[model samples]
Target: MKLLEVKNLIKHFPVKNHKGQVVHAVDDVSFHINEGETLGLVGESGCGKSTCARTIIRIYDPTGGEIIFDGQNLATLSQRELKPIRKNMQMIFQDPYTSLNGRMTVRDIIAEPLIAHKIGNSQKERHEMVAQMLKQVGLNTEHGTRYAHEFSGGQRQRIGIARALILKPKLVICDEPISALDVSIQAQIINLLTEFQQKEKLTYLFIAHDLSVVEYISDHVGVMYLGKLVELSESKELYKNPLHPYTQGLLASIPALDIHAGKITDKAEMSGDLPSPISLPSGCRFCGRCPYAKKICAEAEPPMKEAAPGHMVACYLYS
Candidate 1:
């Protein structure tokens, strides 16, 4: 069952001091996250992965698109109408330090959402809920009295998780949840999230710049480039046999220890800096950097098409 669906999502930020010029952060992106499934969204920096996640959660009002959550069109909802829906959708921000309030105690930070939504009337009830959530994310209940700044990076993230999951949201947008933690702590966070998903059947839109991290937690994976989804498939299938030229290049960039590995010897690498989003390429956004670019690729954009069973690619070569 599809828990959340996004269609043709677009978000453009106007360039400062540049009249009529806008940074195209997200463009014509679409994907669905199933109930109890994780859809990992991966891309390089400035590829619009974060923008996509924020737009879905209404943190950034989309320039244009449809966000359907649990059969309701979020785009059409007024602020009042959205209040209830917001409870079912939550975001776990990428930077735990900035996301948490320094002035508020850990208990108050985690209980804010519940109070905002009027989930509990009394302080005692909210306290109990916060304490239970703290333990669930592997934090001691006593830590709730401490300020967010008092904890380490890993511990701060645990508090963030506790807040995000306190309401038991159906969709959690984990935006690079483990990116800032220590390498050793990363595994613990990943395992905790996986364990929670198994126990609560939680769904996630896991966004990250790291493909390897996405592969570990995702059931399906989508590769984004310049605000567009270039390829999507089952996690293992996408990693093993990427189709788009951009996807292929991204996979090759992954470090390999053995020099004699049977990977693509003449790896396709993107050249030239990414074109300014304010002024994208004429047709395919990636045409300028694509080694396989042809006249048609520069003349017209290619629509996404199924290149293989359960594998979709957006390129003229596949079309």
Candidate 2:
């Protein structure tokens, strides 16, 4: 069963203008995350991956489209009505420093969500729950009394994960959760997340700009460009055989261990500044950078078509 389903999701931020110009942050993107599966949303910075995640969670109310979670539409719910549903969904933000409260101790930070949701009535129960969660994430109960500022970047992220998972949320949106940490610490955080997912049967919508990292953790992957998904496929299939020119370009950029092995003769290199989202190109959003872009690519948007079983790409070259 699908835990979350998003269709034609659109989010636009109004610019500072008397005429009310809007930035098309995320436009008409669609995907789904199945229960107990991790669907990685990968894209370059400013390509709307973060915006899409935020809109689905209603952090920014979507301008249009359907956000269906567990067979119910999230866009239709009022703030008050959405509160209960929020308990079942949680977000682990990118930067631990900004996402956490410096003034609050680790215990208070983790317990706040539990308190807000009224998961446990008594303070004693909350404290016990916090202690257990701290241990679960490789921290001791003693560490809980320390303020977030006292901990290392990795430790602070552990606190963030503990807080997000304390409610046992079914769907966790990890928005570049390890991007701000040290390279050595990235694996530890990823391992912790993997362990927890297996233990709790959690589903994840993992968003990242790093395709390599996304490939390591995701069961399936979606590549986004200028507010649209250009390619999507199983993690192994996508990495082994990326069909779209954009996807191929992204793969080519990744530093491979074997410099000589499995190298494609024609490496696609993308150039030119990303066109402004406010005034997107008429046809393919990637046309400006795609090497194989044709005349039709400048005149008509290509519909996402299946190139092989379970593999899909949006490009006129495929048609």
Error of 2 at 265 (Å): 7.2
Report clashes for each candidate as comma-separated counts: 0, 0
User: Compared with the true structure, what per-residue lDDT tens digits does model 1 show for residues 25-141?
Assistant: 999998888999999998888999998988888878889989999999897777788889888898888888898999999999999999998988799999999999998998889
lDDT of predicted model 2: 0.91
lDDT of 2 by residue, 1-319 (tens): 9999999898998877635678889988888999999999998889999999998899999999999999899987888989999999999999999999999989999999999998898999999999999999999999989999999999999999999999999999999999999989999999999999999999999999788889999999999999999898999999888889988888888777886775743568677777898878999999888899899999989998998899988987777
Q: Give per-model TM-scores.
A: 0.96, 0.97
Off by over 4 Å in 1: 258-266
lDDT score, candidate 1:
0.89
> Among these predicted structures, which one has the highest lDDT?
2
Question: Could you tell me the lDDT of residue 147 within candidate 2?
Answer: 93
Off by over 4 Å in 2: 18-20, 262-266
Could you report the Cα RMSD, in angstroms, for every candidate shown? 1.4, 1.2
